[model samples]
Target: MPPSHTPVQYTTRIHDYPLHYTEAGSGEILLLIHGSLCDYRYWRWQIPALSQHYRVVAPSLRGFWPAALRSADDSFSIAQHIRDMSAFARRLGEGRPVHVLGHSRGAQIALELACGAPQEVRSLILADPGFRIAGEAPGAPLHTTVAKLLERGEVEPALAEFVDAVNGAGTWRQMVSWFKTMVTDNAYTLLSQIREINLDVDLDRARRLQCPVLLVGGAHSPARYGSRLDRLEQAVGQARRITIPAASHGMNLANPKAFNQGVLNFLAGLRADEARPPAGIP
Candidate 1:
């Protein structure tokens, strides 16, 4: 049976910052990293099912909801997040490697951690990874308009613009109340996110990853995301790609059953491979 919807919440200091997270179930650690304008609560559909098989820990990144910035001076950057998450995984695993999964911007962080600190990550799962590749033509800035709307205190419009830009037109209006609330809570994070620049992941960095990688994309997602996954699959020797039917960038939430099953199947395959003896020995 799946665990309760409300997981146990906890807080721990990483890099002297209070990192908030939710914990559920037991066994191998599966760290979940949420994307832009989301917090730990973003995994509402994932925790219950995923926790049944493995320990699930989903953290709200600094500057996001439930981990609010202490002051305007508080820093927010992808590098800082990568550093904090690397430490967070180590602390959670206690010298053991843990499986890492991330969505959108968080996926970029997961990829960075797996490449930068391969010893800390047992495996990696990236869902619609949100980042520009080194050679890709620079896309028009989507954040500037949203940030401007936010600065003018047009919160809903800002959220709408950003949400629609990522998922599709009218997504913000169609979103459920809880999802809207979650995004609204961290809306200010976009201001900080826009300030950070030149953090694109390099293809060479993808090639450096030693852990097995699962690249997941939504069947109806933007072509750019699919292109990124394609490049990544070619770069990462052990990478495998999967698509969730009839879903977009928010595939996990849109089709949790398929997403959950696909993730479980990938992890199960890993466990089975690990259980097998060397080809020459057995």
Candidate 2:
């Protein structure tokens, strides 16, 4: 098994909301953004390995576990998350650009950050980015069904359906107890997520990103994610794609060794490129 270490916890105020996060190791900052039904804990398998080279900071988005919603009026949309994270990055990096790695829904927010606030991001890594691309056919209303189940208080069933919908059939059953607990903790967020509009990304927006991008995918993941990555690769000028074998939606957790190595190699190459002298330099 890969090395695992407990990360130090901290809370910071962003836009008047207290955001909770975990930090480990030290170096260039690497902000981790998790997807649906997840929080900072989702990066448990990542912090230990990646932290050796970079300061890994994983924040639980507002409304997720450990971050209570202030009131029923508190917002929970992608735009709000993007704003929170942009501010969070600025505060954490202290005016320096930080490396960013986001998974699933978090990947969409990371992309938006890279596009909207280019100066704050040095490079971007997206794993199975979960967003509808403009012109793609509408997917089934899985979120709607999950929301209904939550409304009925069938939280487990609702999460199971969603886990299977994205990761593949029987994924929920195979999930470890800890993972299940994490999912259950953030179940209510699905209700708010389903209500959000404009979750789709367009090629023009993807084209606006100015940093290097690494797209990671699970070899066994559903075709939809692969298709989205395809479109993104075509749009982004400096994008690279890789797939982890024997994994699905949760590739990092499923195959951490390969996932970690791939990410580190990408970051290392970026450093090497930076070290190389400009062309025609003596």
Candidate 3:
């Protein structure tokens, strides 16, 4: 049987956006945010694992399913996403600093939170973030990207491709619903909106981060746009990068073992440091 999952529930409106959240486990807080074309469930693996040592809160971003915001801007712009995510963190974190892990586009959001609220963020883990290429801009609309996602093939094949990646991870059955998200709000429409927008990471702003940051990625992934670990490290003064050789963009599913272990190891270092801070800092 799968391990029992106990979810702590909470709902709060962040700037008129009804933020639907799921809290599980207990201890220091770790906020998990998802990238575009997905919701909070993307971190299903992290919560149960990290929950053993920390309180985990994963929330659906502003316009995702369940608590869809009004027909507001649907483009998954980094700044807008950052704003929404930051508001949710502040309202939920209750003024206490917390660690954060964001995957793909969510990684950019995590960086924005750290950049905007450094003191409120203790540490950050950006996994395969699209930090923009040498000659790219940020904040594109979603419709364009959705178009691209579908243009590659019909929805069925796109989903089949994704399902194929997570086949052995035990979540293949769930892919049916997971795949439905593509057509949500007109899949291509949303993708086109998101793609047209300048959806890139802001490294110039990242230079201000004062906390420990880790950039994780895999050896195999479409891996276009930005999202380079080395660039992430350079952007943030106190940052490092880790690459999972046998993994792909779908690290959580394609390579759960290494993905989980890599995350645990990084968090463990933070745990040790938190336990023993620099002299006179307490």
Candidate 4:
């Protein structure tokens, strides 16, 4: 049997809201941020695997489950998430920088954090980020379709449609009841996201990131997603790219082995570089 995915749960007040997170292992901090409609549970497969070599901290973003907001407000914006994550990371690090990993919408927040506070983040791993690049918007027809379904009081089908769009056909049905419940609990946040505008990161700011970056995507994902990764790679000079074969937008959930190995290998290489003496120093 695979190692248990349970993590030690904790909560800390970040700004105006309480952020719930799951932590495991001990070493340099590795903060994992989940995407929209997802909480800390999304990293179930990764937590146990990566915790062996690093302190893995996966936090449920503001307005996500276990603390879902009753009112929809600006508090759920990407800007707000960045602030919360920055505070969360700082608290975890105790003055040291952390390795940040984000998926989908969470990736956008991670980018903002790296750009706004380079000192707080040691590195970045963005998987199937859902955002704009170089003034181009990535199409999300499923978002609209799901919104319509939800408006008609069809929550289950809406959730199923959204999952299938990101993962693959019939993927939603395979998910456990707990996962579906969490998604349904946080489904309201999707409306806020759809109405928001001018949320995409500025490449000009992204170009200023000095930390090592590893861009991850699924080989079977839509072309727009791949293009966004390409643009992001160009913005963060020297950034590495890794594509998990036979996977879609939900690479972390669908192909956790490749996703985990890719991240672990990148981190190991970073550690190696840090230990190596500068050329000509000897």
Worst 10 residues of 4 by lDDT: 1-10
Return the lDDT, model 3, position 29. 84
Question: Which residue pairs show collisions in model 2?
Answer: none
Q: Across residues 176-278, which tens digit of lDDT does each residue of candidate 1 receive?
A: 9889998988888888888653457899988988888999999988888999999999999999889999899999999999999999999999999999998
Candidate 1 deviation (Cα RMSD): 1.8
lDDT of each: 0.89, 0.89, 0.66, 0.84
Model 3 misplaced stretches (Cα beyond 4 Å): 1-9, 68-76, 133-145, 148-192, 223-227, 277-282
Better of 2 and 4 by TM-score: 2
Task: Please give the lDDT score at residue 207 for candidate 2.
Answer: 93
Q: Which ranking of candidates, highest lDDT first? A: 2, 1, 4, 3
Error of 4 at 247 (Å): 1.5
* Backbone N/Cα/C clashes per model: 0, 0, 31, 0
Where does the lowest 10-residue lDDT sum fall in candidate 1? 65-74
Summing lDDT over every window of 10 consecutive residues in candidate 2, give the lowest-scoring window.
65-74
Which candidate has the top score in lDDT? 2
- Candidate 2's C-alpha runs over 4 A off are 1-6, 68-74
